[model samples]
Target: MSSSERACMLCGLVQTEAEFVSKGCANCQSIFDKAGVDTIDCISPSFEGYVGMCKPNKSWCARWLRIDNFHQGLYAVKVDGRLPVDVVDLLPHYIPRDGSHVE
Candidate 1:
């Protein structure tokens, strides 16, 4: 991939194919050097409902996000609508199945 392919979320530095999906880079370390909040804590919460609240209805396409510092989470972005059951099945093994708080 090229630098324009995808940039690191933590830093504005452009990424090549090798680092397209990396959690962070040297630039990220510099940016977060004095930051108070953990960049990984800023993950989007759209999938929380599907994986935690609605796990008995299979009506959406859900998948887990495997990024570092953002593990134990699922994403249902490609899904058409809410899907409880499918979300449950797609939950990562690291996540609890007892409908516990996943934030």
Candidate 2:
């Protein structure tokens, strides 16, 4: 990953910061937009491993990573950093995939 790359804290979408700023996150965009938070607040440059899911619903790896419900794209196996408290509060049914609260 380059210095300009970032991963979404919730969905682990990987992309350039510029892409995030321009396009927003594929999975968490609406939530972040609704929260009125910037991409920096919900994205991190520090992450470990990445998986490109072509078939999220059928891929065991996607299921194991708990990203089966998410859209098909690049996902960080483990994103670093925590989301802001206000952002976390907005997600009543979301579980952190940032290696903070895994089953």
Candidate 3:
């Protein structure tokens, strides 16, 4: 089984992130561009609660998911039911919550 499963708000299914992305997480590639997110693996790691770099000179962290918290990007766009991605290192579209990501 896949290691982790999160419901694709776009597709509305509890599937692996890869499934969501492969199926088209966001309809537009420009979404990533606008967010300045590295499609190849955006952001770095944050050691302190408020310290680290995730998007080139930007301080962020991916450790949120550890607490079931999820992040969303600024350009929260939806296309053909395709869900937008959060946690791009710019700003969160919504409040971080364990409920954001479905298991």
Candidate 4:
């Protein structure tokens, strides 16, 4: 791969940073699609989509980011413009009815 391109950390297919991280390539996106994943914008999701997606500018969008929040699958969000709101109430579409989040 040329220095201008970076190998997708998951699929190892070289691509631009913007494509690999923010907007995935065809192969990676296809895999996500097959797995029922959607890259909807994190903060302002359509609420009818699958898993939430992050923008390249968001701190969590960085491939190097490592955290303990819901296996990093759950991102922090505000409800009613407040912090520390209940997870379910914050993202009713993402959190399960039984109060169980993706493990």
Candidate 5:
């Protein structure tokens, strides 16, 4: 991935850092908004495996990555990071799929 690209810690969606700062996470926007968390705090520059999901509902890869319900876009197979403690505290119902927290 390019240096400017970052993966959303909540959904693994990949986009430029600038885009993240401007738009927040496409899939988890409402969650972040409710938590009052900024996109910059929910993205990781270091992620592995790139996936271009065109049909999330039909793609096996998207299902495997737990992103089948999200919008079509570039995604990281695994995002490496954790949400800030304050953000987590604010989002008691939010379960992150970034591998930072165990289910």
Candidate 6:
């Protein structure tokens, strides 16, 4: 599919012709971009969480996913040559329990 026709993985919003393949739809991408993460990877690990690096300084933001207290996702994170599994675990706490659905 063309970039503009791509859908935002987070919000399912169709991107404008000018915004295909950009982090996400304008709204979701804006939030991710403002997060100041240099690179975002949608990877899966054996554990449970979303792993990637925050750009520029290469900081890691490892986000773990839980469905009703059941671990369900894993992401490998490498930032500035350092690994931070503990920090990534903090993501589950930040995710809203009610709105934690992923598509």
TM-score of each: 0.21, 0.90, 0.26, 0.24, 0.84, 0.27
**All models, RMSD in angstroms:** 15.1, 1.4, 14.8, 13.9, 2.2, 14.4
Off-target runs (Cα >4 Å) in candidate 1 are: 1-4, 20-24, 29-103
Off by over 4 Å in 6: 1-4, 21-24, 37-103
Please, what are the lDDT tens digits per residue for candidate 2 over residues 29-58? Answer: 888878888877999999989899999999
For all candidates in order, the CA lDDT equals 0.31, 0.88, 0.32, 0.31, 0.83, 0.29
* lDDT accuracy of residue 100 in candidate 6: 41
Q: Can you write out model 1's per-residue Cα lDDT over 3-44, one digit (the tens) per residue?
A: 233333321233343443355444334334344434333222
Superior by TM-score: candidate 2 or candidate 5: 2
Ranking by lDDT: 2, 5, 3, 4, 1, 6
Supply the global lDDT for candidate 4: 0.31
- 1-103 per-residue lDDT for model 5 (tens digits): 6999999887889999999888888898787777777778889998998889999999898887888999999988778789877667876576666565575
Maximum-lDDT candidate: 2
lDDT of 4 at 44: 23
lDDT (10s digit) by residue, model 3, range 1-103: 2344443322122334464456433322355557654433321111112222223223233333331123332211121122235433444543333234454
Model 5 lDDT, full chain set: 0.83
| Best of the two (1, 5) by lDDT | 5
Let me know the TM-score candidate 6 reaches against the reference structure: 0.27
lDDT of 4 by residue, 1-103 (tens): 2334443222223334455457664433554444443422111211121222244235453342221121223222211111113322333444221222345
Candidate 6 or 3, higher lDDT: 3
Q: Which stretches in model 3 have alpha-carbon errors above 4 Å?
A: 1-4, 7-13, 26-31, 38-93, 99-103
Instruction: Quote model 5's TM-score.
Output: 0.84
Worst 10 residues of 5 by lDDT: 92-101
